[model samples]
Target: MRSIITISREFGSGGREIGKKLADDLGIPFYDKELLEMASKESGICQELFVKNDESYTNSFLFSLVMGNYPVSADGRINPDMPLNHKIFLAQFETIKNIAKKGPCVIVGRCADYVLKNEPNIIDFFISGNTAEKKKRILERYDIEKNKAEDFIRKTDKRRASYYNYYTDMKWGEAKNYDLCINSSKTGVDGAIKLMKAYIEIKEANADK
Candidate 1:
C-alpha cells in the first residue's frame, strides 16, 4: 500500500479524525502534532516557535530571509542570520520530505499536500461540511461555549485558508485543488472514510494491473 495521504481540512470538519482513522486502519503512522515535535528536535528551534507559526503567515519572511538562516545562530555554525519564521518553515519543509521518504503514512495539515506535491503515489483530500454541522462539532468536541461556536469556526477557517495560500500556490478548500473533497456533514466520518478507502483500493488495484 505505497501511498502517502494528506488531508487538508476546515476547522470543524472532522478531517483530523478521519486521517487518524485512515492511518490506523491502514496500519500506518499518522502525523499532525508529531511534525512539530520532530522539527523542534532536529532544528534546535523552540517548539513554541513552530506552534506559534503553525498554519499561519509571518510578517517577517522577507526580512528574515535577509537575515540568513537562523535568527539566533550564535555558534557561527547556523545560517548566521535567518529569519525566525523562515527558519521554522525550512525545518518543517525538510522534516516533511524526510517523513515522506520513510514510507506510506497519513499526514494532517501543515500544508503537507503541498509539501509532497511531487510524489506520484500521493492522494490528497479536502474535508469540509456545512456551517451548522461544523459549529456543532466544534462546540461539542472542544466544549466551546454555544455562543462562541460561530465565530470560532469562521476565524479558524480563515486562518487556515490564509496559511495555506501564503505557503502554497493553490487556493485553500477549492474543489480543483484536491483529488477528492468530502462534505462530512452529509457523508459523515465513517462514510467518508469508506469512500476514500474504496478510492485508494481501486487506485492500488489499477496500479498492480
Candidate 2:
C-alpha cells in the first residue's frame, strides 16, 4: 500500500474513478485537480492558467529557456523572485515531488508519471478501453450525441498524447512505459482496481525480498 501510483488514462476510460477507488482502498491520498489548486495557491496564478499551461506542448521553447529554472532556497523551498509562470510551474513540480515524499498517493494526469520518474517505489499505469465502450461512456457521461462523443474522444486523447509525449521522452500509452496497462472495459472499474492491487502486492513483495 506504500507505493506512489501515477495513472495516465484515455478519455472516457474512467481512469480518474479507478485512481480514486484505488487510493481509498489503500488508504492514501488521491490527487487530480488538487494539484492545480496547490500550484495556483503557491504561485499566485489562476487555476485556469495552470490548467491551460499544464504539460502544454505549445509553450514557447524560447520562453521556457528564458525563464529557466526558478530559484529555490538552500532547503529546496521556492524562491520568491521568479516570474509568476515559472513560479507556478515550479510549485506544481514541487507538489509532485512532495506528494511522493509523503508516500502512497494516487496522482492523476499532469504528466505525473514523468514528474516522478526518478522515484523508486512507483507504479505507472495507463488505462484504456475499446472504442465502442469508450464512445458509449463518453456519450453518457458527457451527455453528448454519438457523433460528438466520437469526435470528443479522438480530440481529447490526441491532446493528452501530445501533452505526455511533449513532456516525457517516452511514447504515451506504450506498454513499455507503464508497469501495467489495463483495459477497464474487460473487467469494469472495480475489477481493474482489484487486479492493480494484486499486482502491486506482488511487486512489493518481490521488492521486499
Candidate 3:
C-alpha cells in the first residue's frame, strides 16, 4: 500500500477497472483520465487537446526538427512554440511525477511507468489477455458489433503500443519491463486484483525489512 502502482494494460484487459478497485480498496487515489485534467491545469493548456492525444503518439519529422531547435527557458519551462502534442506530453509527464510525489496511488496507462521509473517506491504492472477473451470483453463493454470487435481491439492495442514505445525506452507489454505481468484471461478481474494485493503486501514487507 505504500508503493505507487502504475498499470499498463492491453485493450479490453480490464486494467482500468482493476486499478480503480484496487485503489479504492487500499484507500488511495486512482488516476486515469484524471491525469489529463491535472496536466491541463498545470500547463495552462486546454483539456480537449490532452483528450485528443490521450494514449496516442504523433511521428511528424518536421515537428521533431522544430522541437530540436526550440529553446527551453532557463527555469525549465516548456517552450511555448513547441508542438501542441509534445507540450501535452510534457505536461502529462510532469503531472505524473507530481502525483507520485504526493503519495501511493494507482495510475493506469499514459506511460506512467516510464514517467516514474526512477521513483524508489514504484511498482509497475502490465496486464494482458488472450485474443479471444479480449475480443469478447470488448464486444461486451462497447457498442461495437461482434464481427468488428476483433479489429477494434487490435487497433486500440496498436495505438497504445505505439504511444508507449515512442515515449519510453522499454517495449510495450514486455515482461522484463514490468515488476509483474498478469494474464487477466486466466485469472479474471477479481483474481487479478487479489494477486496484485498479495504481491504488494510482500513487496512492502520486504521493503520494511
Candidate 4:
C-alpha cells in the first residue's frame, strides 16, 4: 500500500471517519486534529492559535499586515515578514512531511496531499457528498438548524477551498488535482473505503513490478 494517504473532504462528508477507519484497517496511524498539537509544539505557537487559524485564511487587511510584520518561526528560520497564516501553514507543511517520512499514515485535511505532492509513495483523495446528505449529517451532529446547516456547509467549504487554493497551485475539490475523487453520499463511508483499498492495493502492487 501507499506509505501516505491524504484525504481532502467536504465538511460533512465523513472523510475523517474514512481516514480513521482506513488507518485502523491498515494498522497505520491516523491524523486529523492531532496535527494541530504537533504543529503547536514544534513551532512554539500556542495550541489555541493553531486551532484558530487552522484551515482558515486571514481576511482582515490590517490584521494581515500586523501579523505579517512579526512573522517568525519556532527555530527562527522563517522570514519575519511572513504572515501568521503562512507561518502556521509552513509549520503544518513541515509537520506533514516529517510524519510521512516516518512511514505510512492516513491524514485528513490540512492540505497534507499538496504538501507532499512531490513524494512518490503518497496517494491523495477528495471526498464530497450530496448537498442534502451533507446538510442532514451536519444537522444531526451539530447544533445547527436545517437552514443554518446549508449556509454553514457553503461557508465552511468556501473557506477550505480558499485556504487550499491559496496554498497550492491547484484548485480545491478538482478531480485532476487528486488521484481519486469519490462521492461518499452515493458510495457511503464503508463502500468508499472499500474502493480506496482496492485502488491503493492495485497501484502499490503495480509499483512492485
lDDT per prediction? 0.85, 0.82, 0.87, 0.84
TM-score of each: 0.89, 0.87, 0.91, 0.88
Best by lDDT: 3
Ranking the candidates on lDDT from highest down gives 3, 1, 4, 2
**Number of backbone collisions per candidate, in order?**
7, 0, 0, 0
**lDDT for position 186 in model 4:** 97
- How many residue pairs clash in model 4? 0
Number of the candidate with higher TM-score, 2 or 3: 3
Q: Pick the candidate with the highest TM-score.
A: 3
Model 3: lowest-lDDT 10 consecutive positions: 61-70
Rank order by TM-score, top first? Answer: 3, 1, 4, 2
Better of 1 and 3 by TM-score: 3
lDDT of 1 by residue, 23-133 (tens): 999999999989999999999999999998888887534223333433455565546466677778888877888999999999999888887888888889999999999
lDDT (tens digit, per residue) of candidate 2 on 154-188: 88999888867765567999999999999999979
Question: Which window of ten consecutive residues has the lowest lDDT sum in model 2?
Answer: 59-68
Model 1: weakest 10-residue lDDT segment is 62-71
